[model samples]
Target: MTTELETQIAKYQKWRENLRVTLEAYQAWLEGHGHADIQRSLRIYDLVESLKSDRVILAFLGEFSRGKTELINAIFFSGYKQRLLPSDIGRTTMCPTEIFHDPSDEPYVRLLPIETRKSEESIGSLKDKPVEWVTIKLEVDSQEEMAKAMASLAEVKVVDVDEADKLNLLNDSEFVTTTVIKQSSGKVEIPCWRHALINFPHPLLKNGIVILDTPGLNALGTEPELTLSMIPSAHAVMFLLGLDSGVTKSDLEIWQQYIRDSVSRRIAVLNKVDLAWDELKDDAEINASVERQLDETATTLELSREHVIALSAQKALVARIRGDTALLAKSGIETFERMIADEIIPAKQQILRAAVAREIGGMLESSMASVRSQFEATTNELKSMSTLGDKNRDLAKKLLAKFEEDKARYGRHMESFNT
Candidate 1:
């Protein structure tokens, strides 16, 4: 049997690459034929690059241990044939993470120090300073080595209480007791990195799908960018909730604060549904109970039932790796995968196409207008010069004045562009 999941990703990537190639050609034409002014050309160039490198960023948001990372592992990294991102019990993804294809010299893990947050630089700017990042080289040939490298996401470093405050890692909340210490001496445990960027040659990511695996609300609260810029702009946001602990206080807070307003771009996942399933119980009864919880969650979050997906991410990962068709179907991942394939990805593609058309199309129109104006002015000058005597001299003077006027207009345009 063929995997529908693989085919969906392939189709999405095909559309994305086609658009990227067209944008690349458009950028080349603009550079070769368009205005030479640095500011004006650079503005168009930035948009073209954005169109070429654009990917559908799927932001997975939930509290700690809600199976956010596990769902990511099952949905994308299952090709590794083993657990790639650490999903073991008690392990938590402690920072905002971005996973995408690097297409560079090698696959590696780059971590930003938590201390860098004190600087004025944005996260995007800090990415250029490789020295400030703790880099880990990845071995693509061995799944075992890759798995080991993946575990670095869970690594943490202990520091004195004072140091944690200096890094702005300390926050007052009931759910934030984990970072505090009650020992005789003042000490605190905190994640060493503020963010992690994993650039791997994963098939899906290489085709243009970026996954943002975020930590709990406590961690997310500290990073304003996640709420203001990242999550708001994602193609889709999956908010995972534990089956046993449906819509807890912390989970609801994250949803209301960040995910609620973007209902059209969000999916509420009831993860670890296997824990609620039983062999002795009738299959119908088990399903009924799960449905009840799903309804309750949907009501609480004010989302439609279709937006809530109940799935066992762990089972799905295992089923995919072992090729267990029965378990795979039971895992509920197929339904979720279909939604992303048929709806989410295609919707994101339409948005990208519209953006390119709006920006690039505008620039093309502006360039054509400039050319048309120059042509008309030259044609008028030629007609006037054809007449004899004083007409020719008067036309020459008028042509010189026209030339000055055009130059001044062009200068004004360039001046506004520089600002």
Candidate 2:
């Protein structure tokens, strides 16, 4: 069955494909009609390419263990019949991870070493230098191999406190003690990678949907690139919170500092609602408890109640893998997916439409003006030739001269326009 998100993405992809075809046709027309100047052709080419490679980036933001990664797995990767990313208890995803499909490259996991943080280069810049990253090829045919490669997302290494501090993985105070683990060897544990990029060929990802799964507050606070560039660039941000914990201080801090005002669309995901399900209570009572938490979360986050969603990502994944329709519906994942399909995807389409109109609209207008000018010139020349049939030889010669002059002027105008 086609999911709502998949259906919307299919529509979006079709729309984009149609637009690309139209632009390509326009470019061919310009070439056929001698209007295809280098500058004009290049502009059209760039626009077409942009449409071809366009992506909708949705970033998930929250503190550690909020089910951010789990929600991602349930929503997008449940088809594998297993958890695709590491979402175990206690800080699994330690660095920012981007999951998208790029057919130009084979399936692979690329990790940038944490030690690279010592350099002034940003993650965006480092991505251009392949040598700077550790590449792990994914065996897409084997689920076990793929899972093993993906487990590297949670890979951590023991380092001295001084090294951890230098890498910005440790704090100077109580936050450090709470967040980082100290070994008996007097060494601190830190993430093995500074950033991770997964180029997998998932269906939705292939249709130009990019998912960014961000780490908790400690990583967000330390990585300026994430808070400064990545989060702000996302089309929408899903701010996940554990229903059991409600809104923690760190979650609120992440919202205020990194999420709020960073993106145009924000969804406060109250994950793990199954925790509130009591067998002793009826359906109404269970719903009432979930609603109360949703209200509280919305009020605390200063978001509308509609924007706050409650779901059990773990249960959803289990139900999906087991093909249990009742459990799937009860998990509330469908509701959340519907919101993405109905709201976020359409919003992205509108933005794309406005941008394309702003860009291609002007070129179209200019082409129309040029066509109109040529039509007028042709009409006048035909009128002159008709009049010449009844005129004397002297008048005919003068009219011919006028025709020559007009043709020359038109040629000059077209040359200037093309340039």
Cα lDDT of model 1 by residue, 23-51, tens digit: 55545554654565676567666766785
- Which candidate tops lDDT? 2
Model 2 TM-score (2 dp):
0.90
Which 10-residue span in candidate 2 carries the lowest summed lDDT? 410-419
TM-score of each: 0.80, 0.90
lDDT of each: 0.80, 0.87
Question: Which residue pairs does candidate 1 place in steric collision?
Answer: none
lDDT tens digits, residues 106-220, model 2? 9999999999988899898999999999999999888899899999999888888888777766767766343356776769888888899999998899999999998787778
For candidate 2, the per-residue lDDT at 90 reads 83
In model 1, the runs with Cα more than 4 Å from the true position are 1-5, 20-47, 173-184, 262-264, 360-419
